[model samples]
Target chain A: MAVLNEKMIENTSLNRKDILWMKIIKQRQLLVLCVPFMIFVLIFNYFPIWGWIMAFQKFVPGKGIFGSEFVGLANFKEAFTDANFINAIRNTLLTSVLKISTSFVSAILLALMLNEVRARLFKRIVQTISYLPYFISWVVAVSIVYMALSPSSGIVNEMLVAMGIIKSPIAFLGEGKYFYGVVAFSNVWKNVGWNAIIYLAAMTGIDPEIYESAIMDGAGRIRRILSVTLPSIMPTIKLMLILNLGNLMNVGFEQVYLLSNPSNIDASRTIDVYIYTYALRSGRLSYGTAIGIFNSTVAITLINICNYISKKIDGYGIF
Target chain B: MEKKRSHDMLSKIGYRRMTAEDLFLDLFIYISLLSLCVITLYPFINTIAYSFNDAIDSVSGGIYLWPREFTLRNYEKILVGNKAISQALFISISRTITGGVLGVFATLCVAYVLSRRDFVFRKVFTPFLVFTMYFSGGLIPTFILMRDLHLINTFWVYILPTMVGAYNIMFMRSYIEGIPDSFTEAAKIDGASEYRILFTIIFPLSLPVVATITLFVAVHQWNAWFDTMIYNGMNPKLSTLQYELQKLLTSALSIAATDTDATLASGDSQKAAVTPMSIRTAMTVISVTPILFVYPFLQKYFIKGLTLGGVKG
Candidate 1:
């Protein structure tokens, strides 16, 4: 009786394995469709992780990644102690904070103002014009910025001088003192309309009956906006805040790289620009990789923290 | 009944006389919004005016909404005199078209496969792709990988790494999932293969999403200069328009920073007709014109796409 029971158990286990294999065979076409892309993802996304090991080694270009000397934490040590890297970190955090706050507040304000507009044609025109800058390349946008900020011929300096606000024209992009403001202003200018779209969508989902009840309670326009509109879009506001927080380390590499010069390098060099300069330009491969690792680590940690907070508050996370 | 009630409420609200406070608020909103429009538009208008004005004449610096001395020399200099700019334009156009098409197709295939509930690997592949959205191998490793693959200084660098994005895939998959399974099942019963169903049915039905993704991918490819700056900087033959503009702008900016007087006074007598400022403005206009042309028609679609992604995300 014991032997019979054991044989039956073995037979059932083998049958289960056979059924699994048969199911895979039945979906062979689907496998063929998916496996190539899986391989593509592995090559482009996952395979490069093996090269991250070079951060530990003193990477020599001609010698290849495998043929490098393994130095323990030396590259990271060099990075943390370097003054420029430290400055880059400071600039990165400061600029990111400025950008997040300015862009966030302006977008919400623009959306609220637009929501109050009763004229459809005027609203559409303003919205369309506002989105134009967002679509253009930063190269082109920077060109416009340079032209507008030029001390000699720029419209901004011209207007200021015309108003007798200053004795001489100021080179807005030529000083470190104005770099953060310029970055933040240009960021808000470019993205305010595009960013407001999400908020506007959220506002549309608000119930009209709530507004009616508020009106019945003798609520004024300001009171209606404050109590009804703001609270209604609270979830969206939270989601956007969390999303922005996750990207606190990424301070627009293209904008900073284009904007940075000898004068403003003190304020403009973020970690991305720093990594590019060291890793690719100067060919400090291992050290650059170590810095890159530092950036990715912080970014991932921020994202995970934000995700955790979001899940705790909203019962859902972006990931 | 609901519509009638809302209409009645709106009418009642409309009947209420505008209070002085409401009038003041309305005026404030309108004035602020109009000024915002002016601020957004003034830079582009100034650029256009400068591009049209003669290089030397623009140096006097009173041009605002209109060109002080109009000429076509800046445009002629860029289009006819410069061989590099024209070649870069060609490279930019080709890459935008190729990248846009391939990106959309790859995104569709992945989304379709993932959308299939019965596909055994759907559970595995979805997470595999989505995990990339949160983390990456960072810049150095990716650069080394591209170098090893011999993609440096090649056109393929622009297309391959960006062809299939996790976000695009997720967006497209959610879109495809909205299609009824009955359609695919019926096609299967009629002996249609997966490819046939995708092309004949899914492709036709998913045109809106396809258009949205195509515009997104194309704009990204068009605007991308960093890739060219990094991977193909040495090869002028593969330089993109945006990168060319970047090179011009950087040189102009550096020169402007060091010697403001030299830039205004540096143009030679023979080619003094074209200055760095004029050429820069002309290039900016050229680069931005294509986007402006398509912006109005495609604006609604992208707004919808963003809202959809935001909701699902």
Candidate 2:
């Protein structure tokens, strides 16, 4: 709870210097270092901000930002009433819960298993192979999943058929019912290993002395893990959960966009996809921005709320 | 006599150290880890094999953990059919290396500046940068701004828009400030210019976080496709590897999945099909090759760099 910079931190105490070069130099090096960052910020970040007014106006490219007619909050009101907006919100919240839970459980289970392995060589190979899928682009990853799940001749359907389970192959990606499942499962497969990396990183930091002490007390492996390993990684677990909850709205557009079909659109249209469709297809820039602004506002507010609660409850958050 | 006695003692200790229960725990751990690895690695290996195996073999449910026909035709499909992807690879590679290297340099400079308490604007700049993270002009505004600047479909759009990010800057800053100030003062007193001090002293010492951010930015640039899709639409040449890979997925698979023509001819030796599964797999391999290659150099950072400048949990 202590404020690291509480005193308004006069922020000084550099060594005194000569008159000729150092007089004018008042840390000129610092200024020089900052110039490029300043330029990047101004051009990419700040300039684009001026276009926020497009949300208010009709947003004609020919009319320009300044020249457009002010429609006020009409775009927002329309977005509010839209069925697609409602569905998008519901879909976003639902899928995000599925995604985070699936990923969180699988990664922890994986880390627990990985930690207990005694054969160092086998453990290393397993860890490396598991994490390989993490590095591939989601765009490409969707393809792999699509191929494996395709209705006519996918390995999954083939195995199911060979086992005489189903009379017909299920169109896993094409229909409304199965699309969400596929999305969440694909997320788990791609991220579980990568997510385990953090927990693994956290676990290695646990003191070896604890294990020795646990052994002395006749504590077994599971007991030692539950008592020592789990507790040690709890801080990371809490921090990551809070951060995940905050950014829960941001389902990647690439995956849904690539995988979704007209039949599955009703199920898979998250907020990002909704806004993308509105903007790209309808050319309703104002309406799209209104939706984007609404989505982002919720995202930002949630993140802040998470940060505040994390700090208040556990005394940890990424400030 | 002492050695024989010690061996007896070690055997006694070993006998006492582990029981059937301990062996069960070890066995359980090994089983779980192995299963987890299979679940994780299966899809990746399947795709890799599918890319090499004939498209017919793959689509027909033959390809799984290993290749069937062992043909390079899928790789050939991508390189031969699309000149756009080939061009995009060169562009992305140059941008990643140059942009990545320059990003590190610029980040180092800013981080150093921010690290110094003497820098008056350090406090002023910190939140200003962080503010952008939480809020941005939505896609429309950003697109309009890009159009206004005429950065659309240009090489500069790829490089300049995300040249230096605030978190990365903060990461480097926190790291640089963690270094002792005395080193910088000592270098300064020896009449080393600021640039010289940076290159010689600060950079060498700051390698851990620098390496960390380098991987972050490089991977980010490599994985980026949304920007290409939105900003450089219709410009096939500007399509990054990710973009090209996406096109292969959607255009090839999404469209082909529906058309009965491909399905009807599915059994044929028809080169007419162009093999959606194979192309997708091939593009996946191609897109991932750079990450796999650079991975060896940067993999150490996954643990070392992360923990060294680790944020307080």
RMSD of each: 2.1, 6.0
Chain A TM-score per model, please list them.
Answer: 0.94, 0.89
A113-231, model 2: which lDDT tens digit per residue? Answer: 77765566887788777767777777867877877787765777787888999888877877778877888899888878778877887777766656666777877667877998898
Tens-place lDDT per residue, model 1, B259-283, is 4523554555645468777888898
lDDT of 2 by residue, B1-313 (tens): 6543543553354347787876787778777776777766676777788778876655556557889778887787678877877787877787788779877777788777777776667778887887877667777778888888999988778778788788788777777878898888987888887788888999999887888889888887888888888888678777788887777666645453453324644766766344655666778888888777776566666656555444444
The regions of model 1 sitting more than 4 angstroms off are A1-19, B1-15, B256-265, B270-272
Model 2: lDDT of residue A313: 84
Name the lDDT value of residue B74 in candidate 2. 75
Decoy 1 TM-score against native: 0.96
Error of 2 at A84 (Å): 0.5
Q: Please write out the lDDT profile of model 1 over residues A175-274, one tens digit for every residue.
A: 8889999999998888899999999988877777888888889887878889999999999999999999999998989998898887788888899999
DockQ of each: 0.65, 0.43
Q: After superposition, how far is residue A54 of candidate 1 from its true place, in Å?
A: 1.0
